[model samples]
Target: MQALKHILYFADGEFGPTQAFRRAVALAREHGARLTLMDVTIESGIGADLVKRFGLADDVQQSEQRLWALTHLAEDWVQGQPARLRVTIGTPFIEVIQAVLRDGHDLVIKPVRERPSSRGLFASTDMHLLRKCPCPVWVDREPEHAAPRQPAQPTDANADPRCIRVLAAVDATQPDSRQLNRTILDTAGAVAGRDDAALDVVHAWQAPFDGSLPGAGPVDHDVQLADVLGLLEREHAAALTALTADYRTRLNGGDTHLARGEPAATILAHADALASDLIVLATLSRPREPGLFIGTTAEDVLQGAQTSVLALKPEGFVSPVS
Candidate 1:
């Protein structure tokens, strides 16, 4: 529950650091954290080849000029605020990760471009950073202007302007479901407390089967299906209640939601419907066992959710005996 003191902002691409700059500044000012603005320059042969093939000038003056402009943009945003600015030249993803490790930054914020042309490269970089970053990464989507503005007057004290609404996605079918749920809720509560945001818990359950192909004739298929769904609903409700109880008093405003569908799809849909600013979830470190994965529902939510995401690794816990 420690306050985030150092934050690294990854700035590159057409977004030109505007969105990341604004978010870093806002969070730093609110928490009195130091901000480091970085613009990564790729020096690989492929990058040089691309520039040459694209007929970029030999002097490389234009690119350097653009970099200077970006640095100024960051500086202007941090004006009249306590913040530090940094600019680094290297592979975008690698440089960002190195900065996080070197500076001991608690959080890293970066803007995600929706559906980039080089999907393969984009996917590789995204997966690598998500899997390897030492600290939590907040991939900010939803353009800056699209974010909800602060209201003139406070309507509910429970709903703070700084309080971000988070929906934690959990799967009850896994053997470690209970432990995962607890970790996710605790992390979400800590973040909400830090930002003065509310926490909402969501658990999505679907039929046991994948349902990829039409089933053959079965005499009691409908009856059997109904029985299975009934059991699932009961278990899901119980799990949701238990998870909510752990942080009921700590949360400003909280609720539990249960839906029947694919975990990733249902969770994203609910987040959109609720206009959540972030989704907190626990990721599986061991895939061979019953648990989450790097490319599991949590990962999908991180890449697909319109809001920011906080993913916690599973460790430092012992399950209670039945």
Candidate 2:
């Protein structure tokens, strides 16, 4: 697998240091990649002294210093990795996105809460970034247990870090399903190549019958609808099964999971069941389709994913934001 060469870590001064920062350092150390620590804070000045009195005065200089306040501690734990700090004040995601595009960072990393937002599924900042960022975004979460206080040696990207179980999320029904599926498999396999970690390929699908189609007679039409659903299931399952068989041979070894329900829920269930470390997926948008496939299912997964998530946009896919 190709290592990430440039990574942007957002150190929102208000949220302070986070697991994403730690993980980004590890990734950078492994790949010897360029790491830029960006601290974004919005400061309005009419009564600047009043804001200072309330301890809310964070200009570029103060924000720069604040961004690195926790770096010494983190660097002590993860040594030999130096990151350039960026301090700016503007709308949070907008500034961050601009930096990514301007500087050509390959990945964006940010920390997220253990539980999803109660108001909706995803944090506003995270959702916004996930939707609009051009490059892949890695959303980091708090580890269940704390590591020992001693500093950790930088690990080789070629070697397995623990059992790096990879979960490749595939949408089989997309217009460009074949290419997207291949990309997902190629990435997961490359990461899991001949290592201690194993890959799990899962395709989440919903049965077509959701009472949307009308039936003529109560009993006879019920049987017909059931047959139609069964046929759809069989067709999809057969195709997925063939693909997984080929993947199993190509990847060396893995278990294929077929989930029947809402795509998001099914993907989450399988990820949790296997305790996946990384989830790789590409966003889906079609002109013929009313809404985005990735918006609902992928967004749901992105919000609830307890592990690191690598979200990719399909080639030639354009964001409406631009």
Candidate 3:
């Protein structure tokens, strides 16, 4: 797999900025990528309003102070690493999207919000980048909170919490899912190999609750359902096996599951079951308006995933914002 060479790390309002920057730097060092840490500020917002209410003479001064602190913190964390610090004041999504497109960044890293991971709920900034950005976006959900020693997701006793496992989510239905699956598999496998971790490939299938029937079925609904599911499982399993046959040596006890349920729900459940550190999946990209075209599975999995996600757009994806 072609490793990412240019990474754009979006600073998350001083919340775990240091750790997020460090992660970007670490991944950059791993792939010889350039790390650019960027922080965005808004000219008018609640914070600005609060500052004005406090009789502060300058709103820009306050923003500068915040960015200044973040820069120092990041610099201190990455003393010997090669990284760049960037600060921009504008609308968050537009500035971030501009940064990614302008610099030709192949990967983006930012902190996930502090709120609980759930379906259909995302921070505005995060949702914007996920929907609009052209490259893979890695939302960093650090295991620790402000308090000491509270891991965000449980980790195995022997496994390193940073990235003990990488999960690749694939869809067996799409005609081009083969290529996407290969990308996700190879990328996830490489990352896992580097960390001596496990790779789990999960494919969720919505069996025909009301789907097209194969033919006239027997009266027993359970029997008919079983027959249909068995066929689907075979096909999905075959695809997964054929793809994974080459990486037998790299993956130790890796698993491929053909789950019968909603794609987003199944993926999330499997990731949680495996305690996956990172999820790798491909989104069906469209050129609709910036926030209007997020795929259902992509949006839900991203919103509810406990682990960080590396989301990829389709081969010929075009951003509507441009």
Candidate 4:
């Protein structure tokens, strides 16, 4: 929720100005944040001796070429916007994270790299960033059609020029979910405010009644089960309301959804129905030690999500990388 101070845009060797790049530029201009354009290339597979014997140029040429291309690409896309361009050589995700650590970048924005057909929307690098990046990571999906440009209006200074819808997914039932829930709401609110977009919050639960019923016969058991279900639903509803009380005014119609089902399924189904442009959710389930994988709910949602995602890690999360 804090104002972004430095944003790193990973230019993934795409030819033109991607939506993610434009978003990074706009956010920088809006928040007066520093913007850095970066790209990563793999280390050379050919050994130095072989290159020297063959009298071939070293892998440094590759880096030089990438830097040149990135510079020219920025000149075309930046359109007088100020930004620094750098090309790092190593594993893509590791280099990106190292850049964040070295430069104190607060947010990393990049276009979603799609795998081959039938695989998934996000590539492995995207998943690594989501799982490991210390700072917030925004993976933007490009629209199928070119978005029509809307003329800038003379509005409040803080108002965002773009119109987009954002969904915030949270868990309210567990004691450990409070911090992450609050974080989801705050980050979603900040994005909605920045884009002047509608925001919706979603929480999922399951019925408390187990198996058949308790005492008596089938009829009494049914009644007891219904009562138990109602109580549990109410408790969940209250918890969701309390978690989102601070964001009531920011929502469209003060909308909040408390549904009974699996968490990932409910969240994804609601997001699809709402046609959300972006989802703000936590990647970790609880406070975990360093080097742990993300929670199951988060992994399932990410795997199934059709829209862009802004993934956040819990406090004290440390990356396994470096």
Top candidate when judged by TM-score against the true structure: 4
In candidate 1, position 21 carries an lDDT of 50
Estimate the TM-score of every prediction.
0.70, 0.79, 0.83, 0.87
Residue-wise lDDT of candidate 4 within 79-119, one digit each (tens)?
A: 43578888888899999999999999999999899877453
Candidate 3 lDDT, tens digit per residue, 195-244? Answer: 78888888787765575455645576667677777888888778767777
Clash tally, candidates in order: 3, 0, 1, 0
Off by over 4 Å in 2: 1-3, 13-19, 29-32, 44-46, 52-56, 70-82, 113-122, 155-164, 211-219, 249-254, 285-294, 304-307, 319-322
**lDDT pick, better of 1 and 4:** 4
Rank by TM-score (best first): 4, 3, 2, 1
User: What's model 2's lDDT at 9?
Assistant: 82
Sorting all predicted structures by lDDT, with the top scorer first, yields 4, 3, 2, 1
Worst 10 residues of 3 by lDDT: 150-159
Q: Candidate 1: lDDT over CA atoms?
A: 0.63
Taken over the whole model, the C-alpha lDDT of each candidate is 0.63, 0.68, 0.71, 0.81
**Better model by lDDT: candidate 2 vs candidate 4:** 4
RMSD of each: 7.3, 4.1, 4.9, 3.9
Clash count for candidate 3 is 1
